[model samples]
Target: MAEWGSAWSTTPSVGSRVVVTGAAGGLGRELTSVLAGLDVTVAGIDRPGTTGTSGVPLIEADLTDDAAARHAVEEAADLLGGIDALVGGAGIVDTIHRADTFPLAAFRADVEANLLAQFVVAQAAYPALKAAGTSSLVFLSSIAAQDGLPGQASYAAAKAGVLGLTRSLAAEWVSDGIRVNAVAPGLFATPKVLAMPASARDRLLASVPLKRVATLGEVVGSVLYLLSPAAGYTTGQILRLDGGAGLTLGGFYR
Candidate 1:
């Protein structure tokens, strides 16, 4: 993958500050790697004991806790001096279960983990982003949001909320010169998806027009572009990075 520096030769130059949540997760770690490669000031928010990316300072905090979530962002801004961009990639994928059988507690917890935490982190970073004048935020949404498949009731609801929040904030924060966007991926080859039963996983992959899971580089590159000046004029958009999984004649689902 090309270094971000090789593409954009603009402000937000060397030493630009960035904060990533769930920085220990598969996608988050990939994002951190690219940011570190670009030699920027980076900070991460992850659960305690998570060995986050090398050289990136991490704020150990439970993002599901509102106070902890806010504090994490505050501390990261302090560590980076200021935040020029944010990637809210922290979330959990609930175990597959029928909607009728899904526990109320688990459903609520999914909402907090996947939706509320993202909002709290973004709110916490608002001041630093506003101060930066020109900034960007990328929220990790999911194909489940658009796919009302069995066993995805709770997860889909939360991810859909993320997309809605992304649009709302994009319109509201544009005045502050913050470009907000979302990437809703389908069938990514992450640990969580890979952990799915082979039969289930194969079924999902076969539904994709491309018949494959999205690569980490593709998703990471999209995030980088949205957070870069290249997408300066782009905001309030949802880039469905689904490997053509959601592009079928009548329906994309199997």
Candidate 2:
């Protein structure tokens, strides 16, 4: 594997202050554990009433709202002293619905949950991230943004928006020493995925060259890489975690 000279550390520096949104979700939870194990001071933000992750300070606030997002980041910054990195993993995938009949309300809600929340949190963290002199912001995007996944019109659009925001922020924040990037993951072996009917699951895997869902470790590792010194020069990039699923001309999955 090609490596960058001396800057190839897969783990963030110990004592780095990091904040993760949606830290209670499956992927977020796993990412937090790995970061904490590396001795990085970690704090998390999730929706109100969500279960808190052990050992990590959890701030429950609605990130979609500007005021609430600012408050959450302030609380997290206070807990960590300051922010060196931020992972925008908080999002929602409301019930899948076709584009033709997807409710206007749901479409708006999905965009707010997935796209707006990310931007809101990032904006709130800007001052702290800038003060850190050099920092990283990694957002969770989805392969739905790349491939046509049936019944996911809103999700696909919102995730696509994330890609745009990632690049825009990277360029705009470069002078501030804050790098912005995103991870676009395909099907992953989460509980919700495992519970899918066998036929549907198999059909989904058939399109991928790897023929299997990604492990939480595999996907989380990619996120960690971006947050680490290894990707110090990488910004405005979307790291796709799909198993060559995008290499083919596969049609939308029903």
Candidate 3:
């Protein structure tokens, strides 16, 4: 423990080589900015036509496509001289839907975006991370995955897959000196979440122990911890950053 602390003291947050997928999205963009401020080298990948903040080497590609995702991962590894960390921030959410009425096509699309895309990126980044020898991977999950929230069946299922992915990968990759985990965050102030009707939002907020939405800084801090050596001994875990909504879950019905 002391040895890791000493190492962290010297390396700091700077000099880390990281790749962030879904880089143009709300959470991704915020994480990228924070990484930049830390002086870490970052390669960002997202769908075409989305612009990431300046200073990162942005690679635009449809990550739902396995081949394109692999290419982007390899390219990001090359650009970073190897990857010390990867943040699988790509996701899709279906709000206000009834499971019985949800179309199979829509359900499949959500799975592809929220679950399979993360798998694609994670698998593609494994070789690069293994080569790095002491790397970390963080997957994005949601509080929806934990409880049976109404109108969130498809999204919940996909995010639940992420939790399973996190645990499995953490076990499989530990021998390679790689750490894997996930953050099952509650409602954050992202565009999608903020767009919920006020009454609906209020209902959700009242259920939160924190009584407010999570800020970008809070989520980013959790990500930084998992990626840094400070959490070196942590793996196969889900950091439930949900403000205790998991403790009591009835108010957030959507």
Candidate 4:
């Protein structure tokens, strides 16, 4: 890992402010910890019942609510005196049913939680990101978005939307010095993946060339690269950290 100062000639200082949504969750917590290790001031937002970790300030907000999203951004900005990066790590996966048998309510809820929440956060943070000039915005997508898994229609659609959002915003904000990008992770050893049935878990692992799930730290590393000056010229792209699962299409189809 390169020192923060040497990573980007124009990158913000280590103590710069970063806001992460879904902070209490598996991936979110790992991201928060990594940012904190870099000496960045982090403000995490999750729903009620999810509290801060490691003494980092955690704000309770259902990001699906536009007003609450805006308020969280405002409060975080005020606390940090400014915002340098906005990492939208909150998303939901409805794995209970196939598309044909999936409940409409469940689908709608997944869309709201995964897709709309990201939109709300990005919209609310646009001003702060623009003000920061060289700020970065990262969205957590999934391999399901591109692979279109059997029972993940809602999650796939929502994460696919995130890819579109990242590209469009990266184009729209280049002039403002804000970079927008996304990470598409394959099966990782997160709380969600750990909860899958044994058979389903084995099948998921078999699809990957590595035959093993990723760690939260590996996923966070890719995110940090995108947000850092190392990827200063990289934006409007989706970094797939799936252990080559996307390349094993024949196995998945078999």
TM-score per candidate: 0.92, 0.96, 0.93, 0.91
Q: Can you tell me which runs of candidate 3 are displaced by over 4 Å?
A: 1-4, 7-13, 94-96, 249-254
Whose TM-score is greatest here?
2
- Tens-place lDDT digits, model 4, residues 1-254: 46665766433357779999989998888888777777678889888788667968999988878898889889998988888999999877745687789988888899899988998999888898899879899999987777776777888898888999899999999899998999988878877678899998887678778888899878888888887778888889999887877787553323
What is the TM-score (0 to 1) of candidate 2? 0.96
Q: Model 1, range 1-254, lDDT digits (tens) per residue?
A: 46665456433356679999999989999989889889578888998889898888878999999998999999999888899999999998855779889988999999999999999999999999999988889999987787765686888899999999999999999999999999988767688777899898787677687877888988898888787766777899999987776667534455
Q: lDDT of each model, Cα atoms only?
A: 0.86, 0.90, 0.86, 0.84
lDDT of 2 by residue, 152-211 (tens): 888899999999999999999999999999999998978999999999899888878888
Instruction: Spell out the clash pairs found in candidate 4.
Output: none
**Model 2 lDDT vs. the true structure?**
0.90
Residue pairs with clashing backbones, model 3: none
Per-residue error for 55 in candidate 4, Å, reads 1.8
